[model samples]
Target chain A: MQKQWLWAALAWAFAQSAAATPTGDVNAQLAEMQARITQLQAAYEARIAALEEKLAAATAPAAASAAAVPAATLPAPSRGGGAGAFNPEVSLILQGAYQHKKKVAERQLSGFWTPGDAHADSHAHGGDRRGFNLDHTELVLAANIDSTFRGQATLALLDDQVELEEAWFQTLGLGQGLGLKAGRFFSGIGYLNEQHPHQWDFYDQPLMYKALFGAHSYTQDGVQLKWVAPTDVFVELGVEAGRGQNFPATEQDHNGAGSRALFARIGDDWGVAHSWRVGVSHLRTTARDRERHMESELIGEHAVAAFSGKSRIWLADFVYKWAPNGNPKDRNFKFQAEYFRRQEDGRLAAADEQGLALGESGYATRQSGYYLQGVYQFTPHWRAGLRYDRLQSGRQDLGSNPAALQTVDYRPRRATAMVDYSFSEYSRLRLQLARDRSMQGLTDHQVTLQYIMSLGSHGAHKF
Target chain B: MRRFWLVCLMLVLSAPVLAGVKVLATVPEWGALAREIGGARVDVFIATHALQDPHRIEARPALIARARAARLLIATGADLEVGWLPILLRESGNPHIQPGQPGYLEAARYVVLRDVPQQVDRAMGDVHPDGDPHFHLDPRNIPPVARALAARLMQVDPDGSATYQANLDAFLLRWQAALRRWEAEGARLAGLPVLQVHRAFGYLFHWLGMQSRGELEPKPGIEPTSGHLARIVERQRAAPARLIVRAAYQSDAAARWVAERAGIPLVVLPYTVGGSPDAGDLFGLFDATLARLQGALR
Candidate 1:
């Protein structure tokens, strides 16, 4: 009986409120009076709350100054000399994947020159093994060092080893559209090179990236200076000088800048829907006895060869994005393509297993490759992408060196497609398939199921 | 060639005469308010339009350029632009507009906010720890924010202090009169139950004494699922709301479906200035909003 009365009263109140008027009925009038009283009470309460908040707001600055007195008495932060505080914005990215592929004896790119041990470390290739695997777990910490500078460090943990992927400091208050960044960092040469692997739309690195810069692209201990033009169109020019210890440039003993890069980018928006950016860059470095291994048909054995001299690469990249009314929350499309041409001019020497030099040659070669990809977000959560990568052994001159150092006439290429679904901004799951023809006389059908998740600290999206 | 050089020289000579305090606003509402307060003493640039979701804005290079050149930056704050503004500030390399600087002003700091979360977690879906940043819908919240903006403008451009003060006083006088007129006209709208698309209109309902039946979204920042829509439909049958309401920027499919199933009128409010054809300025925004809500009554 009590429940029935409660239901009847609820129904009557709903009816009265829906009517939104003071009615002639006595019961309706009483309900309306009760509502008016409640509204008055709420108004008074809100006024009191507002008064209290005003009092608090008035005293907040004094309280803040008092708190600052205590904070000044505390010890200073340890890292980044003369920094402000120890607090830093931190984030962790966890990535894992499952892979299935037809087993191939060697996964080397056949037509192009490759380092012997490039793929020996499975973790370096983003867990390319046949079963379940855990990829790199990236931990990032960033903070403003002081009034003039800000610092960030990203550590990649794989297995039991921790690698410092990037640790750099950038100027915060440099006027005239000028900025400086220094320390170990990725060279901003191409659209994808500066972006971390976790931000990739696909599971694995592109064939062009892998064949050109190994698994990781153009990471170096360097200093960079960039200037952005003050014009309406976005224009940026940058130069980097670094101690190149990674792929394409072997580490030198005494380096007063072993490698250098110059890049220029121009971008603008077309109306409210389209945006585009185009860039060109050049990287020149020296390789000191970079090792390579190849099968020698003449000797019927694997011969070790070394290239020592200058290596130069030219790159051009373009990216275009389209969304309705500059809003990408629902549906959008992105197209990006990068092309690279590399030339090596130096001496190539073939050696035996006992370190005996068999033959030497004055080697000069030019190679080129390009990759283009398009990604479309059909719905709020789902996205699909297609990519095609092709590489050409443009020209090779082995000279009198052994046949093992000779370049084949074949071109390497691959086609890949992927679909990913993001549960939120923090987590995404993807399924990708590719037909790989990167190696000679091999067509390996590859499949990957991957998941990437981010914890703590929201990252701002950059374009 | 001589004429071109003469024109260039003239342009260079006149550049300083055209200079004013450059104000960069993260959204159209703040941009409109800055204009009303600064009048002829300031130049304003709005980063996002009313038809765009402020929370989902991307940090484009054009915004960075604008931010770099601005003397003052006005934002809603309380994490409303967390996804994009931080990047703009960092990449702009302009110290004047960084957080806590004299040129930076966050409007939420001056206004009373609603729906501050007790415990923040991702399970709740994109919760702002400080409070709701959509306090502009409540006419009462404007005076405080306008006063703060005028003070900030004075600090950024001290030469225009008197002009800013006079403009702010005139705006406040006009705003208060409009507020009184709105309250008198909106008296009949009291006690109306509304089903909302998101928590975008919390302060609007609070000011007007309207009851929210529920949100279409299961959680904040999450898309409405069919399961939650069905549940809302079931509840509507038991305690029916008078109308369904949504913002002009939000997708209307969910609200339309609910309105169809529940047999209620759906009213789309101009969430900010320039959100609709009728809402061309700050005054027009609220006028159009109130007019639409009252239209749903019939």
Candidate 2:
């Protein structure tokens, strides 16, 4: 009986041991298979890396490597800088073009100005190759500070620190079509004028803007409040104020009445697939013209024969925009037209007691311009546009300088056209041609090709 | 014209009186959550709908009026509404559902994240690498999500706290029970290797014990390219890819290419409420997603 029980136990033990062998065998086989797979993966990845390295190696040759490329032209990775993926959005647009024109061999000049040594050296001259220049290094920051507030800030290299360009804050909560924002922002004036510095189609500012508002593009540091009425089918009103930094002394930061400006825009976004907006803005500036005379070595003596002081320079602009914002692929048309006129008082020309006009009224210009631009979509990724700009102005109101006194030769109306292809929401390449005629015997035909590339989580854009 | 005039008058009279539970859901993030919690008890209007991205909602006239009449407001709250939500709320004039009011519920209360980036930066490309508001996706967190929701619902409708509690408890029991069954069944799919378009599956995979070998996108928010797809295909060729997952709103191009090249199945899931009525609510969304994946991969 003992032997029989022992035999049964031995049989059971052997059976249990036999069962464990297959499990171990299977595990070993699995482990071997996993090791083989990992090896194959490493080899495969190495091959991919080698191919990529070879491809990159093949594309390294280039032409005209210039450091003058504006930093703003390149869209750098900006994901970690902002509030979100699209915040702190940074884009750089680098444009290098070889222009082929018959007119003039690109004029380039170099010079340096000396300060306070004015009497010592009247002639200081040196020469070198007309090297290139980096025209822009625009930086932009846009974010929502916790859903309740959002804003945009930009700094650019275009104006090259003439204390030009701008920065501003915005308050954007309006229940009705009325939104209220107060800050040192743009004067909601022209179409492309208020866009971020890098968003311009070309590298140059419009002649109309430079001639009238100077290199700053109509920007100043002053508080502006805007009210956009509800999206009713009829009319909407918007107005702003505070002094733009560049307004002349005749246009002190704020005219006596708060640089008071008013705007009224009315239109319907619903029509035969049309949305039209027409508005007018007028500002009654408090600018004063003062005359300083050659009156005196005597502290108490006053020379009174000079022209008196007077507040003058009232500005008005009638603006209009027709945009079709409801297109599937942004294949829309925008027709913008604005007429800018300034009225001045007699004190502007009455040879200030100093034998010079208190105001450079001769540099004064009255301008009317309109742009009819239409964009057609070739594909979701590509768009082409044609733009016609016409600016016609009468002779200078008063020739501040003798050049204008020679003859009030107004500039011939100017025109520009452009074609662009977008690679993605953050990138595009454009080809543009512009013909401009200005008042100072300057007529130039410019053709340019530009490429804007954005890299790494710059965020999302609808287009 | 005559009927239009009469309808306007009717709308005006009915507008103020509909007193039907006025609720505002901050975004698509918690919009669907609020709807599930509110169930047929309230009328919920999602501040941002499913058509466009939640990050770029415009402050329009309709949104303000809707917010002004709301009695309860649910938001994602973690700086997600920085762009346009503030503008709408301030203008809405409804004092009942202000930021600190009882009617407010921030859905992020319950989630525990893994990749909450220690340091935030803008250069590495919109780093929410903090592993944000996406926590609502995991099934394990549903208990906390439901409880937090119940607390907020009781504050707005104290009269229905019992009903809300009972409903939450019932839902919890059902979800927990269903979760157990899913785990049992999903055991078959343990270590199931899948390819996804984004990191959206972090929670789902964590719950199911599955593995996502890799993603198609070069980075979390970056769009996928053909090159990335081809690389994924190479891996799929080595180890047969079972499924390729994508969100409904994302471009199906990447998913399609990978699945076609790898000879695998591509599964599209709704990432938001109202993306499709089939996956309308949270429960339906999970059910449909599981069925599709199980049917195709399992």
Candidate 3:
């Protein structure tokens, strides 16, 4: 009996190994397969070991004859299914580039000067004709837990610095079309900021983004209470609290450090083929007394805004990607774009008031600009894009104040050309050359090239 | 709300006689196979629509509503419907179709996948790179998948056990016969090196004995760069690729660019249902693809 039992156990283990391991590099999928294989292999070994031991033990006459029993065939059970299976998705994105310009980064501004947040000729000062960091890497992890909840965490190593991109949880089974999301995540306040910024078809962000959001780039650690309104139309609403941006020191009556903004966006069911969004944000921060510092317009923005009373920011933007002559997925088409803007009145206090320069800083900087871009997909995987940026700078008297940095005068115009090719879902490469002669003292000419590689199950997001 | 009532009404109107077995299918291809096996004794409906991108499909009131009334549910979940199928499974709340239940069948479980990536990541643009999700494109996968489906369906409707087994047996014989013919036909077309715009039919090529020299696009989601295409073209010129392949809905820019530059013929293959008018059915899809490839290569 003991020997008969031994053979049956050995068969079971062999069947187990056969079941583990499958094709695919999904972390969750491969790990499960590996675990199953180990378990089965162990079980099979023990069973066979026990069988051999039993056969040896049954060598004595009566048991030995009966031990010559039939071998049992066990069912193969190495499978991945049922509940509680976690998917570990691994991704690697490498952006490599060859550039023809010198390194250009916003030199860390002097503390409390808060002036140089302008798209003016003086914004870069002697920094023009400079080469810049061309390579950036972004990695993300996201998974849905059952049907009601999902979480995502992303880590970015870009421009030689690493930061958490997104760490948030979403509740899907809430009120109709309502999703409760919380955690420190990217504020979807701007157009290009929301999508893969580094993956922008162009070599750099539009001129408008550089002016309004500051050269430091945009990100705030705060909580956002948002909802997706129920309807055939796609609507989103959000309220946030964080370090406020864009306020001149002269405009605030209290601390401008803690900023707050409420914004909403509505898009048609048709998706990016055509969409529009508008938002109004207000912020305030405590003023820092930089009495004796050589303060630029960069630092004194909030102090100036606070002193000026009632700080606010109003923004509206729209994008319409049409392929009217042919299919949206194919064919050459024109990419339309436009945006309107205005700054708070009297927020632009000059340097004597410890604010921005005439029109660059604490001055109430009035601004307006729009652009037209067209992308023609000459081939399925090949596309060429051209865009023109026409912009206006707020005059020191009318738009400049303490928050504005320099004397606003020349409003530079920009034109760019981009050519790209997509090889597959995981890899792509592009080249861009453009001239930024729109700003004063900033007649910039440069060329940037980029390549992105995605390996593993991470490629699914491309589809 | 009234739309919900109308959907329910339609289900009631199509209510089958309890005498026949019932089967629920996830895709149209699976639905067709189930009918062929179950013959007059089964009823089936494909839950997913052909027009939708399989990966990004959203499960709405209608699909969830249909799954609840069905006795069996079949899906191609290798994270294929990462966006929605799981929602339907839970919301349908059909105890009968829950995972590990007698009625739930994940058809892709039976076969091996090709080009399984060693890693998976979101930055790769919605990758399932570990393994290809287009398993159904390869007809050889159908036999095992159909067998698994038949077994699950039979287990659910025990009274129709004989009918299910007989049907499955017949399918196996017919498939074996057909496979032999296909084998002979495909052999003459083996050893062909081609470039595919997308890896949509990686599974099909694996079983069909064709070699894909490279894909037109450099990466999965990222478009090709001029430098990359120039290199691909250079590679083609040296060894000379025989064919350039593409899907109907998908563009052929990369293929055309390389084909024109390298002087190779590009074959636009039907990737999915309705990829082309001639590829109306699953069998026809492969046949059309093979014929086009062979003709181009010849």
Which CAPRI level is candidate 3? incorrect
Candidate 2 chain B: 10-residue stretch with minimal lDDT: B50-59
Give model 2's docking category.
Answer: incorrect
Give one clash count per candidate, in the order shown: 0, 35, 121
Tens-digit lDDT string for candidate 3 (B20-51): 65566776667777776677877676655343
Q: Please, what are the lDDT tens digits per residue for candidate 1 over residues B1-298?
A: 9999999999999885487888999999899999999998889999998768888987777787788788889998888999999888877767788776768778776555688888889989989877788988988887766766776787777778779878987898798789999998888888999999889999889989999998998988888999999999999878999999998888889999999999999999989998899998888888999999999897
Among all windows of 10 consecutive residues in model 1 chain A, the one with the lowest summed lDDT is A66-75
Shift of residue A443 alpha carbon in model 2, Å:
5.5
Q: What is the iRMSD of the candidate numbered 2?
A: 18.1
List where candidate 3 sits over 4 angstroms from the true fold: A1-129, A132-149, A153-165, A172-175, A215-220, A225-316, A320-338, A345-366, A380-382, A394-410, A421-430, A449-463, B1-107, B110-130, B138-269, B281-298
For lDDT, the strongest prediction is: 1
Q: lDDT tens digits, residues A228-345, model 2?
A: 4333333435566665333322334334333545655444334323445555665544434333222222222322212212222223332222223332232344344455554423
Report how far residue A107 has shifted in candidate 3, in Å: 9.9
Which lDDT value does model 1 have at B106?
81
Name the 10 consecutive residues with the lowest summed lDDT in model 1 chain B. B104-113
What are the per-residue Cα lDDT tens digits for candidate 3 across A1-463? 5544655675565446444544544577556656866676557645653453343333311112221111221112324434624664556577666667534443221112234334322322112334444344667777766546667776766544666766777664453334455665655554454445544656666665554443323344455555544333435566666544332321223443355556665543233233233333333332232122233455543332222433344545554444422234344454546453545443333344534433323424456556667677675567899988766665334243334433436565778998988665456778888886654455667686767777644522210
Q: Which window of ten consecutive residues has the lowest lDDT sum in model 3 chain A?
A: A67-76
lDDT of each: 0.81, 0.51, 0.56
